[model samples]
Target: MASIARRPDGKWRARYRDDDGKQHAKHFDRKGDAQKWLNEVTAAVVTGTYVDPNAGRLTLRDFYLEWKTRQVWAPTTLRAMDTAIRCCTFADTDLAKLRRSHVEQWVKTMTATLAASTIRTRVNNVRSVLRAAIRDRIIATDPSEAVTLPRQRRTEHAMRIPTPEQVGQVLTAAEDWFAPFVALAAFAGLRIGEASAVQVRDIDFLRRTLHVQRQVQNGPTGVEVSAPKYGSERKVYLPDALVTLLAQHIERVGVHGDDGWLFPGVPTSPRNMRRAFDRTCERVGLDLIPHDLRHFYASGLIAAGCDVVTVQRALGHAKATTTLNTYGHLWPTAEDRTRVAAADLMSTALDARGDQLGTAEG
Candidate 1:
């Protein structure tokens, strides 16, 4: 049964009941609004397709635990998700009673303070959480869906892709020991995690390629070597310049057999943060993220006039569309492509449609 009645606060409230013998009530600002809600609820209840918006009352901490356990992501990824969840206003609230207003306010506050990419990531994370809730049948409606997120502000820093000349200069400035490593990242576009775990044996000098089988990451348990970041483990082709650099670096540093790390930490560790990479960036004067080298690799490929599909393959992306979406903006327009424009395709169509005849008449 369903009906609308005025509450003590002088607002209309829709009252209903679930099959499990529990009363459900939803408040509205107006009587008509309450009646509309009651109509929808009663119609749904009659058809047995009604989804109780407040069916399972669980806390945010409960869902967080559920979400966290279900994630098969890397530890670093888990930590980031946990941190993002903590930053939410509902971090300590009941997930079952989570409101759209709370999410909107959070987005607004964060958008005013945080970077666009950061805000986007937070929105995505919240979406992920609500998606899981819906999948679990815990919630009938996703509150995150109603929330309006901020537009991604295209800042100069966001669009400023690293040029090859700048990349070469930065790598060149690195010390001899770190030079080859930096060059590898700049040229090959391997993530720092992948580069750090690269074994000496992974480099097939004769083949002119490096096998990217795993990655090194920092965790509470210390440095751990795990599979590639995207988990699409694949080999990276070495440019002639980088290949030559690697060959020389191997000979100079003396590779410790196949098991030894190519970019091994100085004190014979998988990750030697105490030396090699640390302070090297500070020394070099490049105010860039370590992972930006991957961008440098993608940007260079785009700049060299390589096809987006091939670049996607070289980067081992799961999809060519992914590569196109991320780095397509950095690609320069080709004169050859202009020759095959939509206008050219429309040439015959325009002629067939008598547009040519109209042009002559005009």
Candidate 2:
């Protein structure tokens, strides 16, 4: 039930008790307005959608702090989200008062300085925070919804696959300790992080497969071993040559224990191999990132007539679409193969007709 009455200040006050027996009141200038507000609140309570107006007064920063504590994100993701929050313009604004214009303005401001991909990432982070606020009834609507973001442009130079000769040159120029790392990435399609985290126990000599279960990530705190990106734990087959090289390397390094890190550095850390990789690339007169080796591996698979699904599994991609988007250009087209097959079919038919004619004439 609800009640409306005149107050001492010449205002009408509406009062109601919620489902939990909590009393709430609001004052209006007119008795009709007070009555209308009371009716709306009572209906909302009966329908189980009532929200306490006072709860939404917290600023975005405060709400985000509360919301973030309850979330379980990967370390790298957590760092990115933290950066987004710290750099947001509306952090001090009230969650209830956020509007679409505010979000649009923020996007405009970010576009001036940040890359399109970076702006999208930061905006999405803020949008996710506000979405949680909506679920908690902190706001009636999400302001960040449908906000236009900067467009992302793909550049050809972003991903490059080196030729086999270039790969050979790089291997020849790399130090002995880092050569195996390059080989694993170039041949086995392992990301640099996954390659660095590989343990001796992860290799299956009999099956010639490497179990990719974890990756090394450098976070705000320090380097730590974490699950592979998107949990893409998969087994990638090893080439016979790579297997033999790994066996010889293991013997030479005198690493007898299965628990030892495949590429060991200081105590409790994987070796920082990027410096060595960069030096080797410079020596070999090639410009490449460590990840390019993984691209080279995919290109080789496609060149050797491997299907999309096989390449996807070899790369440990979470989705086939991801593999397609990254290396779709390298895959062979069905159109070309169809043309070749058509030509072969017509030639065979003509040859068979000639043979029948010769037999009939005889």
Candidate 3:
């Protein structure tokens, strides 16, 4: 039997103890609600699934802290993870006492405030912690996986994929400021840091390639030059236009071999190119960011009939999904490539002065 105590707020308190010699109490708005909760807790205890809140139990926040320390993520990445974890209402809730209902409510609250990507990131963080719990048998199942995920929102402000021609125009427009930046980003698909911190020696003109050995990072503590993001530290080929542009930039700026930084910054932080990029974009009449150039690059590769596997390697991405998710739209239609091949029978009729002839001639 359950005993109920009423408060001035018309709420009732339900009390129970578990086999672990731990006491639990909950306040409900109605006597019926109190009785129902008592039954639930009693049932949980009988099944050995009851969470003894009194047993110095760990909470969601506690689990996250433990898991975060074990991860070797970059400082920026860890900070982002911390932000995601803090947004959860269950961050401080007893991990053992946490139920599916508690997880669901937290998800709802997060969904109401965050974007799809933000929500996904936060949920993934929770999933990481809960998965470990599931593996350790702390919980019977992973509640994060069981809960429904919110739909990803596709907002207008999301990065835009530039057409091949537009990409050329943008580069031509910002010849001095962005041509090299655009080339490295579009042709080599280097992340901002990887590209910005590139040493003059990193450019292999003979092989038509660029080596990605390091990257610049701007974190809360300060700026630091570090290794590439994930396995992004690899070599990638460049297009003829970009190669020519890089060669010219080298000639104009002059390099002292591999030791000379390619695009030196004022504060010596190679990772701080966002402002320079934004200013260059304004001068070019294009409302695009440097990172958007990466999306445009992926889209261009896909449109140019490069396979996903090829794009993944070209961009130094650890996985094909990362390449596909960002620039899947660039994947050209099979028929489009087929039509170009099909038109090979009459090369003389369609060849003109200058239009992206949609030919494999490039």
Candidate 4:
């Protein structure tokens, strides 16, 4: 049974014992308020949903720190989360007391200072923390769930994919050592990180395949080799021309052992090839980023009538939806194909009908 009494300080006090015989107490200014709280606590206990009041007293910062330590995030993800936590405004707010309005206001403030995508990411980070809090029974509901975010516009100019002819030009303009790197990105559709982490052994020349198992990322501490994004380790097929070019590249680089990096820089490290790629692009009069080469590869696959699953696999996308979302515009419209097929069928039927009528008349 729960009990309520007026304290000497003129505040009403409520006390209750949980199923485990753990006593809990809360003070309120009015007896009715104390009774209400006690009743809620008793109901929760009866429903086996009782959460210790003290568990949620910790500030958001405190809970996040505790939660962060238990998570195994990738290096880039860890850096992003750290940045989000540092930039969040409600670090001092109690986890239990945090309200939807507080999250909405935070989103508003963030919108004023950050890009739409960035604000969305940071808000997601906060939401992740709150979600953990809910799972731990520190809070009953997520405050960030109902918060509205700004829309992100997709611009065609965001990605500049070079044509096949332009790709050839860029490859020709690149230096001997750098040509292979460009080819890997444009042909094999490897991310820059995945390309950098490639070992000679990872390529099977006879099989004409490139295996992507890992990636190189530069984090706050330093360069680190980690799993590929979304754990999308996949094998991408290579054309005969690309395979021959890769063989020539290996010979030119004098890679004696299979363990050596396909594109090595300093002793036991991969080269940073961004500047070289940029210089080559400028020389060839093409406005392109290293990632645009990947887009070019996907475009080629799509143009060749590759299905969404094939394109997704070739690009090492974790989800087919991701491939569609990025390159859906490049796919041939089913409506257009349907119209053409319908016309051909109608024409054939009319010709057959006319021949039958002429034969019957004869």
Whole-model lDDT for model 4 versus the true structure? 0.84
TM-score of each: 0.73, 0.82, 0.71, 0.84
State which candidate has the highest TM-score: 4
Per residue, candidate 1 scores C-alpha lDDT tens digits across 181-295 of 6776778877767777777778888888998888777767777667776735887889888889888888897655457766545213435532455556567665665567778
Q: Show pairs that collide, candidate 4.
A: none
Extract clashing residue pairs from model 2: none
Off by over 4 Å in 2: 1-17, 26-50, 155-158, 254-258, 266-271, 303-309, 328-340, 346-362
* Each candidate's clash count: 1, 0, 1, 0
Q: What overall lDDT goes with each candidate model?
A: 0.73, 0.84, 0.72, 0.84
Residues 178-265, candidate 3: write the lDDT tens digits.
4577678766777787777777778888998888988877767776777787867788877787888888888886544346877655
Clash pairs detected, candidate 3? 61-91
lDDT score of residue 266 within candidate 2 = 26
Specify the poorest-scoring 10-residue window by lDDT in model 3: 263-272
> Where is the poorest 10-residue window by lDDT in model 4?
263-272
